[model samples]
Structures are given as structure tokens and as C-alpha cells.
Target: MFDVSEVTVIAVDVFGTTVDWRSGVIDGVAAIAGHHETEFDCPALVDAWRERYLPAVGQINRGERAWANLDAVHREALDECLEVFGVAGKFGAEARERMVRAWYALPPWPDAAAGLAELRRDFVVVALSNGGFAQLTHVVKGAGLGFDAILSAENVGAYKPDRRAYVNAAKLLDAEPRTILMVAAHTWDIHGARDAGFRTTFVERPGEKGPDRPADAAETTDCDLSAVSFADLAGQLRGARKGVDAGH
Candidate 1:
């Protein structure tokens, strides 16, 4: 395992890593359908919504449009998605808006809340994600997911894989990037965080696919740590520390 105690703060990525976004979005779409006996394609809708995500962020990053949080971008994507699925006017304004707000009600993964609770005991735990501040706050509150602080791409004026996002997180927490371990489920996120000079840990949820080491692999692999779940991650990080740090 990597030396985790060297990290003063553990910044987490939300969405798929901390919460089950797919289930939440599927439920929202079903609610929107409203007993119409419609057989909707949840996977298709989820994929399509995600497909538009980066383009929306790129628009803001390129200065073509002012920066908007992930919540607003999700709304825009939701509207486009509903229209594409032939359900444009099916939902009323209030109902449609609630569906958009579902992002705030994301449920924590089964092990996420408990693992975070444990990990928080030994480290300064925070959310470093692409989620908007309001959205992250709402979701964390709704799920009773405790965090010491929250940072997001919205604050950085850019999205993940952008150096600004990672740097902004470390800066706000007054910690060096190398001393911050970014725990995420996505390899790309881990790669980006590492490129930005932060240590990275990969938490592999069930059904979550990531890197597979090849035979005779080099020691210079990207992720600093990897685990099957947050509980396992807690164990790994805890084991990496030889002595207790007072600040944590």
C-alpha cells in the first residue's frame, strides 16, 4: 500500500464513486414517466446524459459560456434527454424540476457512508469533485455522509482532468497536492490527480471496471493505492501509517 499518512487530507470524488447515480437517475426517470406503463431504457438515458456532460463543461472552460455548476449542466442535459426520448411536455415544470433536483438526493453506496465514517477518524476528509457546491452539500446532507469540507470543479471554474480543479481543491484546504490523496473509482480521475501532483487511490466498487495490471508490470504504475471498497481502502490507508499524526 502507498504511504497514506503522508496525506494530511483525503479528498473524495462524488457521483459514481460515493453515490449510486445510476439507480438514482433511473428512479427519477421512472417518476417522470408517472405510471404511464412506459418501458424506458434506463441505461440508454444514463449514457446519453453522461455523453453531454463534458461538452457542457468544455463550453464553460473554453469561455464560450460563463461557468455554470454541474447541477445546472445536469438540468440542461435532462431537458435535452427528455426531449430526445419523446417526453418533452410529459412532465410539468415542478415535476421536471424535481427530477433535475434528484441529483441532490443521491444515495450513498452501501459501504461508502460507513467507510467514510471510519476514515474520517484518521484524516481530514473532504469532497473534491465535479459536483456543484450546493449539489454536493445537499447530497451529503441527504445521505448523512459526513465530510470535513467540500471542494468542487465549480469553484475551480473547470471540470475534472483539468489541473485547475485539482489545484483549487488543494489550495482551498491549504494542503500541498502531494500530501493529498485523491480517492476515486475512475482511472482517468486518478491519472489526472496524479498528473496534478497528488497521490491517488482507486476504490473499486462492484461492477466498477478499471485498470488491470499486466504480467511483469512496471513499478511506475499510476495509482498509488487500490482497493475493492471504501472499507478496504480504510484498512489499506490505516495500515500505511506507521504512527498516528496529531492533526488528523
Candidate 2:
């Protein structure tokens, strides 16, 4: 356990963690192609679109241009993709708009609803994601996720691994770093929170994200719990609560 002092708020990272990006992107592309009267490989397009994600964000962070929301970045990448596949002529402006709207309609992971519902029963649950406010809002509403508050890197004008983003989230919760638990599937995110003095819980959501994570050489090797799913996480939290309740 990081501190075991009775957690008050659980700040969750959206995207590949709480939600399943692989299926979401594929379905979004299928829906867009249907509305646009165009044909594109749903899997290939989903792969291509996500492949551009990191580079696009890095470009913004490098001062190559001002920051744009994930939707704009995704669209820019999609346009380039259409050009690459020699199919730019197939989509109209309206179709393109609808395609972008698809990002706002992600479906929740099967366990997300149940896990979040359980967590909300005990603590103030909020979104702590790299996505912008609009993007996160749409995702939450679309998936019917009941987050008490939505927070983003946009709020800090920076992204993860940056202390400012974590600091901003902590400020919004009006809770000390140690009093809030940061839950995510990515090691970098978990390490970021640990370095920033927050309790961390790592959830494993395999085969639905970009790449496999290498073992962290710098991790404490004793930070906190690593859960294979949200249900597993809930069990750990329940145990932690029991320990707390028992004055252990």
C-alpha cells in the first residue's frame, strides 16, 4: 500500500485504461463510413488513426504548432490517411464532420460501468485523462459514465509525465496528493502519480492498447497494488478499506 490512510477520491484515467480503444476506434470508423457512403478498412483505418496519436501530440508539445484537441488531431491524421489510401475524393465535408463526431461516441468497456458504479459508492470519482474537456465530456455522456468531475491535460496546458497535469488534477479535487488515488493501466501514468506523491493503482487491460509495456526499472517495487481488472481493483480497495476499518 502507498499510504493506506483511507482514500477520499479516486482519479481515473480515461482512454485505453477505463475504455477499450481498439473496439471503440474500429466501431467509430465503421459508423463513419456508413454515414459517409465511403468504404475504408475499419481495422486498418483504426490502426492508422491511433498510430498517429503520439506523434501528433508530440508535435504540439515540441512547439511545432499550438495545441489542438484530440478530435482535431485525429481528423488531421484521418485526412492524411485518406490521402495515403487514395480515397480523399470519396468523403465530403459533411461526411468528414460526421467521421470526427465518431470520437465522441465511444462505447464503455464491459466492466467500466460496474466498476465505476462500485467506486462511486465509496469515494468521489473523477476523470483524470489526457483528453480535452469536450472529448472527455462526450465520451462520458456517450458511455453513460457517471464521473463526479472531468479533468484533462488541457486544464494544465500540458500532458502526462508532466507534474503540472497531476498537480492540476489534485488542485481540482482540493485534496492532497496522498489523499487521492490515481488509477491507470499505463506504467508511465502510474509512475507519474507516484513521483508526484499520489497513491497509485495499476489496472491491467491487455490487447486493447498501443503496445506492451516494459517493466519499469525505476519503480519502487513496493508502491502499491497492480490489478488485472477493475473488479480486481475493487477487491483490492475493499481489502484496503477493511484494513483501514480494522485499524491495521
Per-prediction TM-score, please? 0.86, 0.86
Q: What is the lDDT of residue 117 in candidate 1?
A: 89
- List model 2 lDDT by residue over 1-248, tens digit each: 64455578888988877887777777777877776677767777677877798788777766688978777887899898888877789887777767777777777877888889888877889999888788889899889888899998788776776677788888888899988888887777888788888888877676565354343322433347777667777777888778877975
Q: RMSD to the native, candidate 1? A: 4.6
Candidate RMSDs in Å, in order, are 4.6, 3.2
Candidate 2: residue 104 lDDT (0-100): 73
Q: What is the lDDT of residue 92 in candidate 1?
A: 67
Q: Specify the poorest-scoring 10-residue window by lDDT in model 2.
A: 213-222
The segments of candidate 1 whose C-alpha lies over 4 angstroms from its true place after superposition are: 35-39, 208-221, 243-248
Question: Clash pairs of candidate 1?
Answer: none
Question: For candidate 1, what is the total of clashing residue pairs?
Answer: 0
**lDDT (C-alpha, whole model) for all candidates:** 0.78, 0.78
lDDT, residue 88, model 1: 70
